[model samples]
Target: MNHFFRKPILLITATLFSGSIINAQNVGIGTATPQLGKLEVKGSTGAVSAIFYDQSTGVAIENNHPGIGFNSYYNGGRKAIAPGFGGLLGMDPASGKLHIYTAPASIATAGAPMLLTERMSILANGNVGIGIAAPTAKLDVAGNLKIADGTQGEGKILTSDELGNASWQSGASLVPGASIGYGTWGDCATNGNIGAYQPLTGAAGVNNFGKSVSLSGNYAIVGAPFETVGSNYSQGTASIYRLDGNGWVLMQKLTDATGAAYEHFGSSVAISGQYAHCSYCRRPRRKWRAWFCNHLSIQWQHLAAAKNYANQPCKPGFLWQ
Candidate 1:
């Protein structure tokens, strides 16, 4: 005699859990029809549908394939899963590298391998890379970067402040037919010659105090190529002046470190901003040396120097042009 036993099933329907239904075959919470999978949950509009929590290792979602997939729907219609159709965020366990990928939106095969193009990454050591796999600096980018902080626009360049913060600033503007012209010399009686400036200590004799002069903004630099220094004849000096309420005041005097006779330390001078360049020519040797000075304070600070003879190559410190 053949005998068969039937398994008993228990079905529970609760009204408190938003019409939760439980049966021997499947479980459905917040839904009545759980036909999609063994367990299905449906949430109300604009509310969370599901949540996974773990304190130790965090929540994990897995698929039978390589990378985890995320599905999105619009009006109950599934979007095409393609290479460029979606974005991917992944971490390489072997190399400890994190990568973020992007692609164009196009139709592709679902569950098939995608040609993921890495657009950004973060190394295990905390270096962030953009459009690059490896980053040597804290923030490294392999492509052109645009900073639109409201100050960026056409004809603007990136500039940095004293603290290294960057911002966009307007470039130098040139006016049409703009040129600087000098006035008549030795005419202090008129505006032609603003005022006569001379070194109080070196006014004893002829010092060639005005041999060379350069003006930038409100500052002026005068070169005295024949000024004597303690017994060093014609050692040369450069005097810087600032235009203040009391007229032009002598700010600082610059001279070469080496007080050798006939060095002509300030035969040529050029001033720009808070810096000045003093150059001297050795006509006999057909050579020249130039020194840069920072006059941010009342004192002059030597910044850089370059020396070259007619037969030798110039050093890197100073540029003639």
Candidate 2:
């Protein structure tokens, strides 16, 4: 029974085995068999580079409280995941928190995750909003964004998506002579609401503009520089349509407010609000563009076309480029 030192070797083996069990307990994990006490681990050194605790091969230390049984150490720390492609599964965006995903099938509100998202950006209230993105999209919430529903646009909503061209929506009140659609906001009251898409050369010629495509209010006053110097802006006619009980109904076709013709589009009516304002380029390029003032006589003698004017403040009758 007492050969040499058999008991000492047995004691050494027992001590090592006991140490493994104690380590597992500290990490709150179960042993090889289920229902054992939790196993835990502490960092020997203060700093650890790796984030998540790897337990793929580690033992499942047992837990005896409520709910699910086994527990294992997962190194979900402050940052959650690498900055590269972290999702809701990432560590907390805030400090001292861990991100957790709720069970898909189970009704655990523990960590409710939003569906249909590759990555989630936190809102001001810490709630998540859904956003589909393209490759060229940037990831940031630069400023305040508003969301509204059920509120219709203030005026006439002219959509051109059906026409396969530039779509536009103008207010109910339009003005006369204002050549809308890149040309000019054919005359209207208040400020000319630019149509969605306008002609680059709508003011003087046709299809003769290389300006970058853009959108403006009222009449879609597009590419032309500010000062178009011409006497006759009568060629540009403004038509008004109302959305009736059935469909869009043409209300009126105002050929001329002064009953005279200027340049085919001369310095005619500029559309704004629900009216038009037109004047001689020589008068005041800004005033004549979108002003809707009551006047019987549009003196052709005073009117002139826009020649060289670009980017100016829009008045009641005009819009700044």
Candidate 3:
């Protein structure tokens, strides 16, 4: 049974029993006037404001789903929180789905109501949704996602490691240079084949590139016998490449400086280790000239030294017909 005591000006009512006070429909502790809601407790300096204790041993909400609800009469609405042994649990009562919401501001005054935005949701079937209410997949997100692991780039793709960890990686750039064919002369002339190596600078032209090619380990040398240098037609050149993470990259372009037009400097090429040799028919000397380039240094000044092997006997592997 509760009794009411009416003050002259305040009109206060209360029923006190064993230090507990109940006034009409409102309950107040350490305060006579509870202005905010039905139940209010005003705590002093050295004490805790409020505490919710659960007696359950396991990590689950066993009994009734008890929660505190907040509502406003203005434009905004209600936000409920259910505190339990499994941390803070927020759920939609009608759908029984776990929903997480965030408010833009901390406080909401009289006229201006608080707006709550739902950020994440976990369905009853264990499907998680981000930026969306209903999820069709196991983990569904409506917005764009970025995985920054230092290997991500614009033109890269995701690749998995040995342990199934994924990271962004670059693929080889297949810039078409020329076509190579195999078989008899009639078959090579009629059927067009596919495959080529990248040029030193830009795209390769109608020059007879890949007419002669030599490979030594991860290094390769290709001959462009009909390549024109400056005003000299068919002066010819050879390109050397080294294989790396980004496929074969052009290292240097080899050419005979003292050779004249129609000499075809890179007619035939051979590469053994770091040494590269290129031979061509010298029409002026009526004999073949070869440039034995020693890639022993990074400067690549060895290609400038041309050697005339006119009188010397032709070595078996070095000189290819």
Best by lDDT: 1
Ranking by lDDT: 1, 3, 2
Question: Per-residue lDDT tens digits of candidate 1, residues 79-158?
Answer: 32322354455567777787876544544564344344678989999999998889988999998888897777776667
Worst 10 residues of 1 by lDDT: 57-66
After superposition, the stretches of candidate 2 with alpha carbons farther than 4 Å from their true spots are: 1-117, 125-267, 272-276, 280-321
- Clashes found in each candidate (C-alpha, N, C closer than 3 A): 1, 96, 0
**35-139 in candidate 3: lDDT tens per residue?**
666877665222223443344212222112222223211112332222221222366667778876555455433323345666788899999999998998988
Q: Give the CA lDDT, 0 to 100, for residue 10 in model 1.
A: 100
Q: Better model by lDDT, 1 or 2?
A: 1
Q: Rank the candidates by TM-score, best first.
A: 1, 3, 2
Best by TM-score, which number?
1
Better-scoring candidate (TM-score), 1 or 2: 1
